[model samples]
Target: MKKHNFYAGPSILSEYTIKNTADAVLNFAGTGLSLLEVSHRGKEFVAVNDEARALVKELLDVPETHEVIFLGGGASLQFYMIPFNLMKKKASYLDTGTWASNAIKEAKFVGEVDVVASSADKNYTYIPKNYTIAPDSEYFHITTNNTIYGTELHKIPEVNIPLVADMSSDIFSFPVDFSKYNAVYAGAQKNLAPAGVTIIIVRKDALGHVDRPLPTMLDYRTHIKKDSMFNTPPVLPIFSALQTLKWYKEQGGIKVLQKKNQEKAAVLYDEIDRNKLFRGTVAVEDRSLMNVCFVMNDEYKELEDKFADFAKAAGMIGIKGHRSVGGFRASLYNAMPIESVKALVQTMQEFEKKH
Candidate 1:
């Protein structure tokens, strides 16, 4: 049976990206040397690196003021790196979910953190609004999408200070105003590439102002100076990212994909709302397009596992929600076919009938 992938991430990738990367593993660019064995600085991989960076700039429409870099650590590293280079005396953050809370913890080590707004009061099922950021704060940080709670800050707040965001699970899934942010970073696993490599886009002027010394490795300038070659980059994921970027552009770019993502989220969410057995966890306005979170209605909560098994038996893979939040999450990333969402909706419908 064909499995419908809803694993969040390291989640589903486009079949094209997967197949191409697999082929490159055997023989990259017809060089007979596997991508795994090639020298990162060699002319072949150099081109790969160059094209990957170029594609990022091109796809994001990143301005000339910003530099895009591929780094080895997942976005977890960026939590500190962001504060390391940007936080001088203080930084502001929005506490929306687990990752955002983690980012807040990391930034506090660097400077004072003002959690301007939070939905943690509600177990993070909603986005906090009408909060104020300190103009005196060094910078403001936000996690654009919360994977755990299934809430999204779909409308980025207008902050006068330098805005930094962790877009780990949602970057490239939609069109964003590149000009508004001083920095944006993401782990490639979700909507970009694979489990390795984190993509960072930093406005050049935002650095060197933090007034403290950053370790050579932790410093953003080091990576920028070396063109992300200050050390061996995650070569496989970078190449695979290039493949995905190429595929994204060929499929009519992010604006096109954003519409599809919205439609896909709508399908599953419609079922969650219409069906008697399940209900969405997040506020309807704040529901995540990438991670649609829901659960069995309170009256039918005991059947959650049975529904999970039923869906799994019907070829749904990885629909389980995060352990902390007991429910279900269907991740609708760029590569997920609408058919998979339809199947999930159908499975939910069938389960409702069975119960």
Candidate 2:
């Protein structure tokens, strides 16, 4: 049997997507050409690109004004590209955690960055509120979910300027009003596909407005005009993303997935609250549905290693917390089955009983 997967990124993918991608690797769509050998510009692969792009728009209900394009670099590149393209003089950023702070770091290279708010004071355990966005700032940036800290922004900030968001870890896992964001970028590893592709959705009108001339490749208009084919795309991962998108539609879209995700997070969170040995780390109101983090109780901290070994021996995988935050992190991505979550809960209970 396969072990339960709880790693943060390059994480779990739907078994259905995996099987189809494997079949494509053997012979894509019965074209007698392996997916690996096929030209990205070929008709068969072009269809793959078209369908994946369409599915993203359909899944997100993105408006006609927004152009969805797949790019080579992960969200890290977008962290810089966003500011490079949009920030002429100044920008605003919300500091949430590791990724968010890195995004802030990138924006600093392009222009003056005004940190609107930050949760660093509390070790990023909670989302900061009551921060003011600078009216003169070119755009406001936010990371919707702090994967490392297990905190999420339940609400989107309303502002007159463009609202750019990095939804790398939470996109498609929950329902979002796509229009509220002038631009959105997400790496496929978390809830979409493998690590090769990053999805970028930007309002068409929002581009070509910055004063600085962006490089041809970094320009959003270039990818949009070429239909994300300025260069060879990560065909296999895009195909895999299409399969995942198909599975998502068959499963009744994001609204339905949101309910299922909530249920899955509830199960583990409830267990974390009930179990005598473990307790959640993030604030109750800001806990992430995608990455549920918990730590051993203060009195039982010595047993953390033992419990980790116990879970590992019981077929659990990738539950180790990050270096900065020492605890267990169970990443419940979109493709993670409810049964797997239950298995983790059961393991936690069984370990608690033994302790």
Candidate 3:
């Protein structure tokens, strides 16, 4: 049976990315050495690092003022790094879900953090609205997409102070106004490459403002100054990312990918709404294009496990939700085709009939 991939992180990757990466693992850049064993300082791997950064800037339309760098720690490390390097005295954050709340928790250790707004009152099913960021705040932070809670900030908030966002799950899913943000960072697992590297787009001018001294590895300036080669980079994932970027450009870039993502999300979301057995978790307006989360209707709740088993038999993989928000989560990332979404919907319908 052919399986449909829906894992939230370390999610599905394009065949183009997978095949090319597999080839490189055996013989990287025409060098006989496996990608896993290649020297980071060698010209072959260095070219991979350079092109990956270049592609990130090109695809995102990142401004000249910003520098793109790939780092070793996952986006979780960024939770502390943002506060360490950017927050001078205080920072403002919007709390929408688990990750956003985690980011807020990390920032508090640095200094004062005013939670401008939060949807935690309702278990993060909706995005908070009508929030105000303090003008005197050092910077405003937001998690643009909540994978676990299945909500997204469809519009970027206009703020006076510098703007920073954790765009881990939705960075390449759509076209963004790169000029508006001082910094944006993402983990490579979701929509880009694999699980080893995190890509950061930081405006050059935003650094060197904080009074506290930063550790060498923790500082963004150190990596930016060295072109992300200050230390040995994640060689394999970086190569895979470059291949993914090339595939993205070949598919007509972000705008084209955005339309495809929207259509895929709509298919599953419509089934969740129309089918008698299931319903969506997040507010309709804030539904995520990357991760479509839903659950069985209240009366049919007992059949959740049965439906999961049936879907498994039907060749579905990784449709189970997070433990904290257990139900069903189909992560429809950039590489997921609409056909797979239709298959999941069919599985849901077949299960409803059986029940």
The C-alpha lDDT values of all candidates are: 0.91, 0.91, 0.92
lDDT of 1 by residue, 23-114 (tens): 99999999999999999999999998999999999888899999999998899999999989887799999999899999999988899999
Backbone Cα, N, C clashes tallied per candidate: 0, 0, 0
Evaluated at residue 69, the lDDT of candidate 1 is 95
Any idea what lDDT model 1 has? 0.91
C-alpha RMSD of candidate 2: 0.9
In angstroms, give how far residue 135 of model 3 lies from its true place.
2.7
Model 1: how far residue 280 lies from native, Å: 0.2
Q: Give candidate 3's error at residue 316 in angstroms.
A: 0.8
lDDT per residue, candidate 3, 1-355, as tens digits?
Answer: 8889999999999999999999999989899989999899999988889999999889989889999999988999999998888888889999999999999999998999989999998889988879888777988899999999899999888888778999999999888786777789999999999999999999889889998889899999999999999988888889999999999999999999999999999999999999999999989999999888898999999999999899999999999998767899999999998889999999998988888
Question: Per-residue alpha-carbon lDDT of model 2 for 1-355, expressed as tens digits?
Answer: 6699899998999998999999999999889989999999999999999999999999989889899999988999999999887778899999999999999999999999999989998899998888888878988899999999999988777877878999999999776676677799999999999889999999888778788878899999999999999998898989999999999999999999989999999999999999999999989999999999899999999999999999998889999998778889999998999999999999999998888
Candidate 3 displacement at residue 107 in angstroms: 0.8
Error of 3 at 249 (Å): 0.5
**Model 2 spans with C-alpha error above 4 angstroms:** none
